[model samples]
Target: MGLLAVPQPYDFERSLDRFTFWGVDRANVWYEGGLHRVVDGREVRITPAEGGVEVEPFDEAIAPVVRKLLGLEFDLPPFFAFAQRDPVLADAVRLLPGFRPPLAPDPFEALVSSITAQQVSLHSAYAVRSRFIDRFGVAFEHAVAFPTRERVARAEEQELTALGFSRRKAEYVLGIARADLDFDELDTLPDDEVEARLTSLRGLGEWSADWFLARHLARPHAWPAGDLGLRKAVLAFYPDVTDVRAAGVRFDPFQNLSAHYLLAALRYR
Candidate 1:
């Protein structure tokens, strides 16, 4: 019989709390006993335990991350109102009970990951990234550590491509690593200046830069004008999503939160 163990250390819920706009589809958590992140895929399963929750797939540590993400405790104005009548969106999100994803907190990794994800399937991206990480990243037991510049800088372009990364992505990753400026320096700059610097990389685009800010830096107003999901979700709902610069107006100030709202909303249909 399984002995009851107190949920300790790992906290997925708390991690989820800080991000109001999480790409976390609880189903996407790669659970092989240890918590992992899966791209563009989602799976959810939970069973009862003697003293606590017996969650399948998720590791003990994942609980806090889940709670943190589901930290939307008190209802906000429009969000509260919106949740009241919208059954579709509500149904998809109701299970969370309390979710509050923190703003983006990993600018470098976020940017790099987004670049790898361009026009690719989620699992493919995850697979490619897993290999890249296994090769270049140092072992990180406490939490996932972002790859070091030296590791990335030292890698050959072909090696990355062989791992499913496109030449363009490989170059971009190397370019970023090789650049004199990095997160330490970039963090000191203002948001616009930081974005400008990152955009200077070979494969980086305006959209990718914005994604870095919105997802990793937690820029309140960060918006991705070129996002396919934003456009599709907008068109699917408001129908004015193709308005380009103005397309971002739908969720201006809280564009980051808006992404979450849109995703939560889209999950309805």
Candidate 2:
């Protein structure tokens, strides 16, 4: 077992809530109060521990992957300071102390997950995504690794549809998998450039691009304003704000974390 040190004011369980938010995500399995996920082709069971988390059957090389999974790179002190200025945020911070937004460790998985979530209830999304993972993902002892782009690239459109994807969504997933675009290069591009590049693709839109920046790259200002849950969460706190996307400007540099906190508050409420 290996212990990963976390920054102060980190809530291990709550940060992991998003994985199971829709229910029974195969990529991140919550079992026996421990989170199980594939790390460098090996399944690691993680549990909350003092000042951080404990990883069983840990490999030193995969520590970075584990860190990303826990979202340890995001500094919360600044966000906490900003929260004090807003009544709603202040209350949320107080209610859910140590809350940190988690990231989707894999870039492809992040985009694919976002695509699956489009226009459908998250519960429905989970069902479809779980099916897709089970069909193509490599199975480990406790968790399933999300399918590689190569695996999906070879998948037939009808096969994806049979797995519960809409025809357009199946095309989108396949299109992305087969695209010549290099995901690694996307990490070096500016947010607007990334958005432009991804939106240039057939099915990816501003919403999917925004989430990619937020969840995969961990870009600070990436606010997923088009999300229905975010809209509802914002309305619950600031009913006067009509356009959530426009209101995103107020969140400024911490918009991504702010959006997450608001959604977490709404979910727990």
| Number of clashes recorded per candidate | 40, 0
Model 2 regions lying over 4 Å from their true place: none
Best by lDDT: 2
Give the 10-residue window scoring lowest on summed lDDT in candidate 2.
7-16
RMSD values for the candidates in order, in angstroms, are 8.0, 1.0
Model 1 Cα displacement at 111 (Å)? Answer: 1.9
The sequence of per-residue lDDT tens digits that candidate 1 reaches over residues 40-66 is 122223332444334434644554433
Q: Could you tell me the TM-score of candidate 1? A: 0.66
lDDT of 2 by residue, 57-99 (tens): 7777778888888888788998889989899988889888888
Backbone clashes (count) for model 2 = 0
The alpha-carbon lDDT assigned to residue 216 of candidate 2 equals 84
